[model samples]
Target chain A: MKIAFYIFSSLVFVALQTTIFRELTFIGVAPQICLVLVVVAGMLSGKEWGAICGAGMGLLYDIVSGRIVGLNAILFMYIGFFVGVLCKGFFKHKRIVVLFFTAAAELTYSILYYFFAFFIWGQMNIIYVFSKIIVPELLYTTVVAVPIYVLMEKINDYIERKTF
Target chain B: MRYIFEHKIAVLIISLTIVFLVFMASYTSDKARANLGKDGLSTMVLPFQIVFTSVTHNVQDFFAHFGDLEAAGKRIEELETQVAVLENNSRELEDTKLENERLSSLVGIKDSLKSNDSIAAQIIAKDVSNWYTVFTINKGSGDGIADKQAVITTKGLVGYVSEVGAKWAKVTTIINDGTAVGGLVVRTQDVAIVEGEFELQKDLLCKMTYISKGANIVTGDSIETSGLGGIYPKGILIGIIRDVKPETQTVSQNAIIEPAVNFEKVSEVLVLK
Candidate 1:
């Protein structure tokens, strides 16, 4: 039941990421909601659930929206695991931690993505990508992370109580 | 061995990442088969995506209509005058001689162009990695949509369908770097080549190259598809030249074009089947 619930919820995130979120662009760039979902899932759960949920979400997104089959799958999985480890050491309730975690996840995803997707093709424009796309995305994702974290926390509570 | 066994989940995740990357690399090298998975998944998610796309569009339209209402009144008055003039012109067309020549010319032109068969579709999805601005539309193979078909809005050419599924298809827009279309100056009848670039897209422009030294093209000259490629019909409006850089010894002459179709606001498009 927990597995099914996570899968269902993650698909909703993927659906919204592509459809609704694309329309509500913040200065021509939209927040990567699936990235946020993976991070928030890690924060709310442990590394185990985080990795599982991230892989599922990433694979779904890759198949639906990505050019590469498993690119986002691995990228998001690492983010989920890393978030779980970092938040475990820090005060997860703190706003600064949330900002830092979301920012770090976005940064890591963008770097790995640029390298994997563009660097291989000799299209990596580091200055332009970092300044124009990555930094603005990081800021937007960080701001949006607050509400997402709250939603994840509630979802986590429901999952935990149901399982127990 | 015991240490590795003690942390099974971490080991599993690490292994999974490595495996997925290896497989992804293989798939990238041979992307022809990659569409199998994508087509299946897209078909599965079509209904939900359609619902979300429609719901959001309705909500957006609800808000956009409030702004359009005030302007619509003035537009209606202007259109009313246009109707009167058109009605008078239709009455003038009752003269048989002028009408026959116009009809014959239109029929001759239409015979040369394959522009009649078209299907309308609504955009359902778009993502950020879209240096190509890849998007999915609701109609698909079931609706006779196919790959490499031209997509256009009422204003002008929009893009081409790249992938098709059972109930959905993905479109690669004109702003993507990979797209190349044969175009030329409509006024001077000088042919040129147009291509997409991520850099120029920031300014909402595209690059048009291969202009001859004496082409006499200038800023504000209209560019239209030359129909040499057979992918799109001839004479479809592409854009107007925004900036002209004269030919250098090393580089061909080129111009930056501001596309006639406002890509950002494109909601509905017609796919030439």
Candidate 2:
């Protein structure tokens, strides 16, 4: 059932990202839902489940994006692993960690993305991309972290009812 | 070896290595990327994109029309005051178009154009990442849509087809990175190349480069497709010049543009066949 729920939310979030969220942009930036799921799931479900959910969702997201496959999956797996370890046991009912995890995820993704994608593509404007894309997108994603974290907490609780 | 597999960190590293290898393979192989879209997943999900886009579009339109009615009320009052002058100006403009065509004949450039064949396509999805601008449409080869065909809304030029599937296609807009559209400043008749830059797209703006030094382009001047590129039709509205950027002084000038089409609200487009 947890696996089934994961698949269902993955599809729903991907659909939301490509449609309504496009219009729900702030400062010309939209929240990265896949990244949000990674951070939130890690905080809620602990190391193993969070990493598993992140990998599954990330792969689906990569396919929907139609870009380099598994790029997001790798980032998400590590993000889920680290966040899951960082807040493994003490994270229950702690919502503020959502903001911290999201910030860390955003910063990491931005730097790695700028390095691997933009710089490798011959765009040597790191400072420009850092200031313009990274900062603004971080703020955008952080603002969305609260609502997503709250929702994922409920889903996590539902999944936790049946013991492993 | 058994203990290594039992360690969580070891398992994580193994997963990371596998995904990274797949990523590298897909990055290096064009066939891998093609297989992604052409494979079974996209076909199964295509119907959901259509349905979700339709529902969202309707809800958006419902709210949009409310705003439009309010704006329309104000326009009605303003137009009532200016209706007389606008009627006189319209008559004079029609008369000038006729004389302008006659003069254009001597220059070997016909300012006339016939209607283009087109098909209406519903927007199915927006780009997953905001870093790039790409969208999916419901019509494709079945509707005679092909790569590089221009997509436009009633307001003006939107984008062109970058990729096509049997029943779906991807349209990369001018606001997307690396896209370019040749533009003409209506006020001065000066031609310029409009290109998308990441810095400018942050503000939902594009950069119109290669502006002639002698051209008298000002802020708010309407820019239209120059038709120099055969991809988009001639004289389709591209945008309005917003401001001049002082960078790149060694070459021609560059100006910021606010595209005529409101991309966020665009639900459907007519694709030139």
Candidate 3:
């Protein structure tokens, strides 16, 4: 049942990432719905499942972006592992943490992605991509994080309680 | 970690799936692009397009009503003032027109340089962000705007059609990073590659790269397409050179060029020579 929910959430995340969130972009910032979901899932689930979900989400993102394959997968896996470890230690179902996790995960993803793109992909102009792309995006995604986190918490709690 | 090592199989499966998808996507990209060609999507998108157009028009009308009323009042006042001004300026205009006609004749110009083979197109939508200065124009393949066709206004070059749908075409502007055009400094007669930089800015500008290092260039020098690439015509005005930054230990110089056309103020454009 949780697996089914995961698949459904995954599809919804991809669609929203491509269509709706894709439209909600500022100058250097764009909402990454997939990254948020992966982070939230990481917080909810343990490390292994979080990593798995992140890998799957990142794979989907790479497919959709149509530029630079495999980069997102690598980044998200690390993000999930790190964020999950952080959450596993001493975090409750707090809104601010969830928001922070989401923003941090996205920032980490962008940083790694661009770094790889520059070094591996041979892209010129090694500018500070994160400071521009991630910082503004962090604020935008943080503003959007509260409601999503609340909803995710409810869903996560419901799943844990009901499935058990 | 113990958890990750324990779920090695799941990790492997995830990694394999990604690799497989990437391989499939890379292998099928050309075929997919061919299959999902503009024509294929147009047929699918037509119905939705109509609905979107109608909804947008209705919403625009609804929102524009109050603004239109305010504008109408202002316009009436302006029109009255303009009428008096026009009446006063009529004699002056006639005199000016005579002088302009004489000067134009002396310049040895044909009365009509541009034939009626032009299409007027309105920008339907800009891309999600200004990251790519790509816009969808109302006219498309149906209206004879083919791929690689230049889009221009009375002012100068707007962009060229990169992709064409049935009723819409994506005009990738000169400011888009992926674009490059061979341009000439009209004043110096030196060729350079006009390419877009990553940084987006208010002034519609492009970076002119690969200029001959010793070429005489100055700010305010007119730049135009050299027609070396055969994509654009010989002398479509691109921009004025804002700054010339000569390459260090390289045989090229880069110049900042302010685009001749203001993309923001653009409403209609001509897709032609």
Cα-based lDDT at residue B83, candidate 3: 96
* Cα lDDT, model 1, residue B232: 82
Over the stretch A5-116, how does candidate 3's per-residue lDDT look in tens digits?
A: 7656765665454334544456635567677777877787867667777776765555434334466766776677677878876566577788777877766776666566
| Candidate 3 stretches greater than 4 Å from native | A1-28, A44-64, A73-91, A121-127, A151-164, B1-14, B17-172, B185-190, B200-204, B211-222, B233-237, B246-253, B260-273
Model 1 DockQ vs. reference? 0.60
Q: What is the interface RMSD of each candidate, in Å?
A: 2.2, 2.5, 6.7
Model 3: colliding residue pairs: none
lDDT tens digits, residue span A41-86, model 2:
7787677767787787777776766667777777777788788888
Candidate topping TM-score: 1
Give the per-residue lDDT digits (tens) of candidate 1, residues B1-273: 997899988798988888888868767532422266677766666677778888998899899999999999999999999999998888887776467768878777553245468999988877534234778888888898877888988888888877777778778777776688889789999988888876766455789988888788888999988988878888888989999998678346888888988877888899987
Q: Which one wins by lDDT: 2 or 3?
A: 2
Candidates 1 and 3 compared: the better one by TM-score is 1
Clashing pairs in model 2, backbone N/Cα/C closer than 3 A: none
- What lDDT is reached at residue B62 by model 2? 95
Cα-based lDDT at residue B234, candidate 2: 89
How would the docking of model 3 be graded?
Answer: incorrect
Q: What is the two-chain DockQ of model 3?
A: 0.18
Q: Judged by lDDT against the true structure, how good is candidate 3?
A: 0.68
Q: What is each candidate's DockQ, to 2 decimals? A: 0.60, 0.48, 0.18
